[model samples]
Target: MTSAEVTRRRAMGAGLGALAGALAGCSGASGPVLRLRLATGPEGGPYNAFGQALAQAVAASGHRIEIVPVSTAASVNNLRKLDDGSVELALAMADAAEDAVLGREPFPRPTPVTALARVYVNYTHLVVAADGPVRSVKDLAGRPVAAGAAGSGVQVVTERVLRAAGLSGAPEPAPVPAADERPLGLAASVSALREGSVDALFWSGGVPTPALAALAREMPLRFLPLDDYVGPLRERYAPVYTAVTLPAGVYGLTEPVGTIGVGNYLMARADVPQDAVRDLLRVVFDRWRDLLREVTAGARLEPRFAISTGEVPLHPGAVAHYRSVYG
Candidate 1:
């Protein structure tokens, strides 16, 4: 976890400390002094920016926070980090969260982490070699692709989509050693796709992802519908998924492509001090628009969409805040 800490700490005003401390299980989690740690994804990715915004929002609320901005393998690592107490907050995909909470055999032991809210939907975009024989997703049958980093949420869903699309990821168990996989990094995956080193790619992220955006600028690219598999995927996975469309020209692409995606959520260990969590959510909803303006393409954030996080259960604290703000 490569984390950039947000050292700008502040004191949560007045008597809120004792209240927040009690909820966090702290003896004195008191006196305008609480340093909450947050784990964010890679620098350019949405989570990092979102996490930073959260940290700043909390800080602005006069609470102390130690935001550990990290470049994650993505979802899988995020969940592990949270469950193990490596991080207090993490951005999670709905599918990954489901796998964790259910003890879904192949995934890590099910850990009942609480969800703060489903911030937004992560659109699964498949990019293939523009000049290669692969056009639609089906064309890449029996080929290699970057699912996502091992242990990252990307790999989890990548394999799911492949199976959903009637394909499979490398069957060689532990294809790359876990430790080896750790440093393999996203650049390797992106590079593999660029050189035709792989057949195609399936990434679940917010629209105009840096990788997709970069590839679109460097070479020809297309977003595969894979929507054809959505209905079946939904029937099986159900609530974790929903249809999200990448509007035409979003990536400056000529046509719109519909794909199946899951929501991106902020999750916390159940004991994150309800008062702190309570204050955090209050600030986010109140100044969301201003926060969005800070991230390059974070315009997708809107108050109306903020409460749409039904995919992941809202943090009881967040729900309290939401009810007060929008309910």
Candidate 2:
């Protein structure tokens, strides 16, 4: 670990220890109560919903760990917050976490972020109106698209998909609206699509996102297939992109839609205590079903799946937790 990483770990350890001591003393409890801040996504997004569910599950698990979910702009923002020690935990896309570790775009330098688990897979949705002129990914060229909220993992993948489709340019400035310039959040993007302000929008989330599912009920929407771009994305970036299928009947589609899928990783700062991590992971795996109820449909959390966090190294606590399970 770098000097900065060591400093961050020490600071986090101190803060956690002090807080736990104070809480124990005040409550006269036998043990310390650990409180951790988890950075999730904006309102009505999968990250936010999942984080809330996880927090609730942890609270009910009879463990002393308290998870406080903090909503932000999603993956990129969450990782940045984790790096700065503002949050102890963050939910991020595999690509964003990879970039943070590799010190890619959006991150100024290599950040010391570690993965606790690979939670679930996020399907990329390139949504357009069912009756609109846009038909395919290429049709989005020169048209206004809500690429995702600023500083979101959705935007990171959206830009790559757009570039792969040959729509290359800096994201449109907020002041000067251009064909491909909208960076709206899930709720706002859905509203914009309803209002016809944006031609299409890019969103990465679990199948049947609440906002989009609700939108589908109100109006006819089409999800353009994006499986073709997955190969290029994987080739260019890390092998974090996969071709996944959205089955029919989801969002009222007549046929299944093939799209790019990325894994969502539950991340932590490098310096968090191992025992705390082990305890948290215990609750996570033990209550995995309850946690996924509100997050996604038809997903499973296993030690095998959780350990495949790609390039981001697992925290020492995570490794210990998994080892205890396997051994």
Candidate 3:
């Protein structure tokens, strides 16, 4: 192995040892194993895939902690589950986490959710049939569109994007009846687009999402440019959205497409045990490459990026872990 590979392996081994020691000290020689429920996105989505990989990696490290991945609507739903104490951990979009922590529209009151890390970036995808009538965001003014699952981060961003394009009204906390809007998950959205029930669909996820990739194979697909609305979205909300490009050759694209980007955060309830949180972060950082391979290829994770969760305060354990690393 190369020098870099050797260093990485050594770091992972040390992290595993720290985690094992921490867990052993917490639970005596024969204490019960600690199980944590992690709320992930819908099946077949990046969040779910990442959660599963992280869980497996943690288990393989020989730690006495079990991470149970729970499927749910992405982002918004995940934060709600974390807030209500239904799940100890959750993956959510940074925007959604900010909303939850600040008592924004979707959340009735400020939620006591803390961040574990800013895990990755999610690209907003506005997909339409190659030869469809909706060629741009404004073209969806009267066309039927799948606006993402009802309680998903995709839906929250979709509403804002639509509003920025002057194609929709103010976002409501609950889904409102509209002739052109359909609140469907990734799977259902793909089926609807194929069946001609929806003219377009919006999804925010890692590039080359499996469902979309499969759909690309069945027929031609076009990704409408969303970079133009980043400014408007930032003006209306916090500066949580960034302009990003979907590289060429992904999902059969001939050229890069510009879109809005948002960070994905791993969050936890405010009351979770500090040692548990620290142990989890150890595995996440040490095995981040495995997570990227399982979720999004070409994605990146590092101490700087992981600690950049805006507005969402890091958990005490996370802060401790980072301090130790920096020291």
Candidate 4:
């Protein structure tokens, strides 16, 4: 048999098995066992893809998973959902986790949550339209912009960033945020820019985002430099926020953009069985490469960059696995 045929068969089997597992979980047919739900973002973004990959890997380990798709604006909402027994697992930015637990910014109320693992970096890029007058963030004053969806963790930090830069409107300079009707998921937001609906945008995501690839098709879009912002982010949000660069070819971008970023963590309700968390961590790092294939965020998933929890405690189960491999 040819290599292509073998690859196709493997994919088919995996897809079939995933379907069976999802059905079994929904039907309560996977025998009598504890169940967990994951609140992931959007329908087509990398966050949703990452959630599916995680479900697949866990399903392969004889566990059932029910994925709850939510808005990217709702990552912070995941915390409330987890706390209130609506869902069990979800992705969150590290800074968001810190502030949420401490009752800062968007949270406005304390949320007692912890970490399962440091999953991916949330690189903040001040993206602008190719033909727009805004070359840097300074030039953006009265432009029509999409800050982010309401209840979005990105919106929380983005508001602060705008204050730091003295810009307003959507990124904070505008008197009011753009209506949520546009629903700027990474791909949609970039498309809006290309079409001239939005003059500037801020995206907090992992490197080499597929959405950025679409925007890169525009020959002259620029990433606003934020060397100054990085220092404040580290100081205000915790040292986990680090300097980052969206490299040239990562998105076919003309030049690297200096920016600040934070981590996107895979977290769960504290009530999740330790055994499940342990097994999930084992399957994840073991098949890390396969997971990467399922989502572009995995392209930058690295153990070295995955350990800065600051005060956010790691799940005991995950710490056991991380120490075994890294030590």
Best candidate, lDDT-wise? Answer: 2
Global lDDT for candidate 2?
0.85
The lDDT values for all models are 0.64, 0.85, 0.83, 0.64
Give the distance in Å from residue 92's predicted Cα in candidate 2 to where it truly belongs. Answer: 0.4
- List where candidate 2 sits over 4 angstroms from the true fold: 1-26, 170-179
Q: For candidate 2, which ten residues in a row score worst on lDDT?
A: 17-26
TM-score pick, better of 3 and 4: 3
Candidate 1 off by > 4 Å: 1-32, 64-66, 169-186, 290-312
TM-scores of the candidates are 0.79, 0.90, 0.88, 0.79
Q: How many residue pairs clash in each candidate?
A: 8, 0, 0, 6
Residue 76 CA displacement from its true place in model 1, Å: 1.5
Q: Give residue 269's error in model 1 in angstroms.
A: 0.6
- Model 1 residue 85 lDDT score: 68
lDDT of 2 by residue, 1-327 (tens): 443564355345543432233232234564767788899999768899889998998888877788989999999999999877788899999999988887788887877778999999999999999999999877776789998999999999998988776675544222222347588999989999999999999999997787889999999999999999989899999899999998899999999999999999999877678888999999989988887777778899988989998778888899999999887
Q: Clash pairs of candidate 4?
A: 168-172, 168-173, 168-174, 169-172, 169-173, 169-174
Q: Which pairs in model 2 have colliding backbones?
A: none
For model 1, the local distance difference test gives 0.64
Error of 2 at 83 (Å): 0.7
Give candidate 4's whole-model lDDT: 0.64
